[model samples]
Target: MSLPDELYNAKFAEYIDSMKIMYLVDDRFKMICDDYCISKVNAEKFRQKIERDFQHQLKHENLSKELEEEILIYIMKNI
Candidate 1:
């Protein structure tokens, strides 16, 4: 995902938004966000990123139901 200065700057916001949404739906997301001092005003920018990511991953990953559940657990643990 590396790029030239302007492109990187542009995409950085998207990636941050993605991470913010990842935290948003997560059960522990609020606690983690507060720990990092992220404000709701900024966090709201991530509202759709998680659903987008889920759709993308679901379309591309093609995992079995069990594997999908496991992957979700792994993500929850690491985040």
Candidate 2:
């Protein structure tokens, strides 16, 4: 399966190949990637609303980072 576009632009893009393999073989990993993609998309929206609602923007930023870390750790363990 093709990954969400956000995955390619993320900081952990370097490990994308591993992520893809995991995504294809592991249902949990695929769910994680889907969640990560949703979190990232929401974070991007929040970033645009930074001036209107800084708190939510900050919250999403932190959540996005956490999800990114989770993906990285998952990939590492499976790789």
- Candidate that scores best on TM-score: 2
* C-alpha TM-scores of all predictions: 0.25, 0.56
Candidate 2 Cα lDDT to native = 0.87
Off by over 4 Å in 1: 1-38, 63-79
Record all residue pairs in model 2 with backbone atoms less than 3 Å apart, i.e. clashing. none
lDDT of 1 by residue, 15-79 (tens): 76565565566647545555544444345557667778889898777667768899999999999
Question: Per-residue lDDT for 23-57 in model 2, tens only?
Answer: 88999989998999899899988777876687778
